[model samples]
Target: MSAVLELVEFDAEGFMNDAKAWTPEIGEAIAATLGITLTNRHWVVINFARKEFTEKGEAPSLRRITKTTDVDTKEIYQLFPGGPAKVAAKIAGLSKPTGCI
Candidate 1:
């Protein structure tokens, strides 16, 4: 199967139709993918992910995101196709980019 197809099939919570509406379950899925503990302290990941999509017009790389957050890049890529960027973008309600997604 294609990488994107496989990514879509992975056990993430819901589809990326609306990340802003993501529930705790969705957040947990994103956090699990990034190998991070999702406590109240890390809520910024969701907000940052949203900001990244709005500002950069693209998902932030795992490296770039981890530099700003506590999530790990290696663990993120292991779970998601394009790593933290993709997962973060999805959770942030951003549309999947053409080639990247």
Candidate 2:
């Protein structure tokens, strides 16, 4: 957490405007706010998502997550509750993924 960037600055959806400032501690804090505990399964999805965003400049879709990361949509939903892509991205400390409501 930076001296300046407060978690409240993030959107209602919990995405920060300056995603580059994201850190694992921030991610954990965001997840706690969202009522999600970071599990190893959750970490796998988050890591895959961040990697996809870095390589493709876009967050991977639910279908993409299933197709590429070998994580099925059902498991994703279980891991993220609410909206998987959006919640997961916020917890991953990335920008709100495109095409996610």
Backbone collision count in every prediction?
Answer: 1, 0
The residue-by-residue lDDT of candidate 1 on 48-94, one tens digit each, is: 66677678766566666778876666645544445456555565555
What TM-score does each of the candidates earn? 0.45, 0.83
Top lDDT hit? 2
Q: After superposition, how far is residue 26 of candidate 1 from its true place, in Å?
A: 8.6
How far is 97's C-alpha from truth in model 1 (Å)? 5.4
Ten consecutive residues with minimal summed lDDT in candidate 2? 1-10
Q: What are the RMSDs of all candidates, in order?
A: 7.7, 2.9
Our tally of clashes for model 1 stands at: 1
User: How many residue-pair clashes does candidate 2 contain?
Assistant: 0
